[model samples]
Target chain A: MASEAQSSAPDNLPLVLIHRIPPFELSFKSWLPTRFRLLDPLDPSFSSPQTQSLVSSVRLLLCLGPSPLTSDTLDRFPSVQCVVGSSAGLDHVDLATCCRRGITVTNAGDAFSADAADFAVALLIDVLRRVSAGDRFIRAGSWPAKGQYPLGSKLLFSLVNITDNQTWWLFQLGGKRVGIIGLGSIGSMIAKRLEPFGCIIAYNSRRKKPNVSFPHYENVMDLATNSDALILCCALTNETHHMINKDVMTALGKEGVIINVGRGALIDEKELVRFLVKGDIGGAGLDVYEEEPEVPRELFELDNVVLSPHRAVATPEAFVALQEVVIANIEAFFANKPLPSQIELE
Target chain B: MASEAQSSAPDNLPLVLIHRIPPFELSFKSWLPTRFRLLDPLDPSFSSPQTQSLVSSVRLLLCLGPSPLTSDTLDRFPSVQCVVGSSAGLDHVDLATCCRRGITVTNAGDAFSADAADFAVALLIDVLRRVSAGDRFIRAGSWPAKGQYPLGSKLLFSLVNITDNQTWWLFQLGGKRVGIIGLGSIGSMIAKRLEPFGCIIAYNSRRKKPNVSFPHYENVMDLATNSDALILCCALTNETHHMINKDVMTALGKEGVIINVGRGALIDEKELVRFLVKGDIGGAGLDVYEEEPEVPRELFELDNVVLSPHRAVATPEAFVALQEVVIANIEAFFANKPLPSQIELE
Candidate 1:
């Protein structure tokens, strides 16, 4: 259903500057222009003068894909007061620069939270239960030829006696301390979904969220020490880069598992590999890596690690949701209403 | 925490005929002797004369693992009045013969439900999100070689247009109608866990459970027609063997997923292989098979199915719980109290 105000002619409709790099086109690109007349600078049809004129007049800009949203890009659209991000995580967008410019930013949190959260849980379960490892064993004809894929119980760090190495493969989730790195829309949903499975939920966000009943650790080390699994849900920033290092992994001990869905640089990838290879850490389930597309070849051989392309929010439902959030944010901006998923700048 | 009655001398303790085939040892075998005076004909120490006298005296017997319990085995233990099962699904136990002989039966439902339910949910999420497939792509160096994993939307059967194959990769869990075949302990737990994920739960049990609020279909075919996924949680009895045949798969259609943490013979393995190969069915997550440790070669070629060697209830927590249940049932039977998890003999 089109809002009455959205029915205006192309020239009369509020313009949204489409800021995206090559090969990173916006999802739902075809339908985007139906609501608002889009002004994509990269489009060949937008002559230099026409693009300049539209950029100067447009009050809102849309940042699509994980391409860089640098200060130089923002400089081209000095008139854009609000940046409607097409993703939940704004690691690609220069949040600090946007904050300095007093440019309000709205993310795709409303759209991406559920599916991203679901994927996080999926990865966690896979690693703990050896779901991928078992599938590999079966596909390789090891089930019939190799006799049995290790059915011995694994004593997890979450509920372990470290002195005992003979413990059975527990593959148990109940009564484990699951420390969430961020308590935003995605992390909180993860906590909620895991609660019924008997996980003891806690968190270590930048700032402790108010009124949240989950115990909040002030730092990553403390959280890692107390957690069986560490799930990353916050953004990647200067402060958080390499936040999970050797010392933090040491504190997590030999039985802890780490799951990352936020970004590749959240953990020191090199350190993580060494720990996994040496069996210093129990296991890891990673969706995003320190580098895109190039996963550590070393990881390919380890059954303890699960690697995924950066596609946590790649589901069709998330796309539909992203479109709604983008459309709502733009329309709200023009209507002088509060944006649906605007990020509160520190 | 030994019960006072269990502190008696082994010779004074009541005898429980340990009826098990080779390789089918009790999960907590060593711990069983502390609670009962076990009589096993298969034990070499128990000479044929000792076994004959003990078997005729024992009033209770324990059926461990998935080995068959035939009428011949029952005839040898003429005095046994109750059979205590050490596993949840009793496909191996001959129920009709026991019922005809007016003997009672009990299963390890309490011990197996939580872990079994957790695995079922794990496989469902894995199949739907292509968790294993993504991991495979990354491990195979295909992530770099192949620009993107399909990432297309799969229009599901429950809320679908059957003709349109161009839909996005939904990977959606919310709003999907999940039909559970048996609304027993494990099935109910699965429904509870999925409720937090926003799944619409329904069931197709032998009869509608008295007060379960979820909608119930009288037959598997009707349930398949109306649902997007079918999870088998019941036993593989004669009535239920091959219940999910081609007709049911056709009704579930191209977009439906099936998860079986129950016995694999619950669905016709040959027909399922054909459907998965033809893309006639969406996907499957199986922990058991019609044949032990022998998965079809065709399934290995398809990414749609996730297979786990029959280890659904193999966890330390489950073992600990099973010991508790087994002890409780034996204690209750000897004390003349109702057996804790006794199956109703119809």
Candidate 2:
């Protein structure tokens, strides 16, 4: 049965246009060889005559990871009606153009939500408890030399140096006020995961969601003001780009932590660096950066920061789930059926 | 009111013997002044004159962090009726001796449970998700150079290297079977936290616990055979010392992860190091070692291991809570009331 499913003949198979940058192509071919035929516009061997027929007849477009899907690319395939976004976040795709063309957009949706939310919680605990930093400390052989990690400050460990002992405290997960920037599927899942940690869940979204009991902040500033930690879970849109600016960082304050699993550019990267370096903010746990694969050099030395290489949904299971979703969306589109993860454009 | 509480005239108050080594002294004195007078025989100025009189009258002894409480130490304070343990783990205290002498023992039970459980979950996620390793990768500037940090083998990342790709997979916590060694307070809390992550929880304790629905294994080997990970949360005692030996490690297999937040001696350190170095086990996230403050030098170079100083309950809040519990227990002992965290010996 496995061998029979691995069909490679595609002379008359339904063609789907694959969009991706150089060295960043999707490997969905092996998953569904007989289900559909994928045509790559970026392929160098595609000479004119047959390419025009193939490109003009394609009705579905598969947008690969972080690849820009523009109107010009869409214009080549006038028959294209649906763009299957392989990522949970569709920031790179031109949603406005898709709206104008009446083209439907589908996403991985809940396929990556759990993984991303799990990562958000992981980063939160890792930062709050200093998991990664503690590992680094032990790896550097600093445990015996430094006496103890002292989660808050070294001075707090020595009873002799403690001045106002009653007021002194350290980081613990219970009773922490965490404000989420987005309360979508991933954000809600993050809230669910944090519920048992005894975290106070609040959120700031484009608009307040209905039937949800978490306190809503009208704006990011208000959310930051009330939160001990601000988790950026919103997308990177024109309005949301650099939403977490200097004022927002200042509002979060010196004792606040920031965990970002959303798209980069959601925060002002330079300002965040300055605040972290100046000890103006407490700490940050980042899985995405404004310029990913090129994290700020300043973060390399900061113990308060945890830097990841934009891999919140890079798990093999997520990759498989995404491919299945993309295939199902295409099959649904051709049959005039409701897509599994169709996104309504505003 | 605050000044009235900080009384230094501990002279004539009810005397309690403070049992601790040179550096491991309890700071409970400042928390409850004017309540009790502590007699320390270890003090250089604790010369014969008043020491004998004070030692003879003392009925309570405070055992500070990890300081040995052998029968010999108990012999020094023959009049002591109860030992107040300042930590959650009472392995250092001679519980058998206390039982034989008909002396009661109280510990910091639920006080440190939450923090330790939180740390255990943090370590588990950190190990399985490669949180620390990912941080290290980004810090080392390998993100730009290397494409991504594969949670499993790097071979799984490249589709170009696909050979028997169907059987090859990566790690995700959703469906993982986690076997906990001890389903005590800390272990139960760890299970509660992991429930949201969709993990399958099972356990092995001294015997089957009452009212628990999770599957129970009679021995460590059986638990290891069925688990994707093993979390050690049981106390260190004669039966538990090196309970996770070479046979247990072999049973856990190459894809298994070990998270130890209980005690160092829970697993044989040298054997653990050998297993980790040979990749016989998948990974480990350790907060304690067999010989802590001196981790195996071999672990320093392994990516699959995360080493931390034995500071699982070193949070400031835990410290304050512990101090309060110790004071409460001492107060209850004098009032002939039930202690908050008194241990019953079999």
Across A242-287, the per-residue lDDT of candidate 1 in tens digits comes to: 8999999999988899999998899999999999998899889999
Chain A TM-score per model, please list them: 0.90, 0.90
Compared with the true structure, all predictions reach lDDT values of 0.81, 0.82
Q: Which stretch of 10 consecutive residues in model 2 chain A shows the poorest summed lDDT?
A: A148-157
> Candidate 1: where is the Cα deviation over 4 Å?
A1-9, A27-31, A148-168, B1-10, B26-31, B148-168
Clashing pairs in 2: none
**DockQ result, candidate 1:** 0.40
Clashes of 1: 13
- lDDT, candidate 2, B1-346, per-residue tens: 7876665466758788887665565454454545787677787667778777688768999887777888888887888899999888898898998998889999897878888988898888777767888899888888878653332233222434444332123367788999999999999999999988889999999899999999999999999999999999998888999999999999999889999999899999899999988879988889988765788889988777777777677666676677778889999999999999998787
The docking category that best describes candidate 1 is acceptable
Residue A298 alpha-carbon offset, candidate 2, angstroms: 1.5
For each predicted model, how many residue pairs clash, with residues at least 3 apart or on different chains? Answer: 13, 0
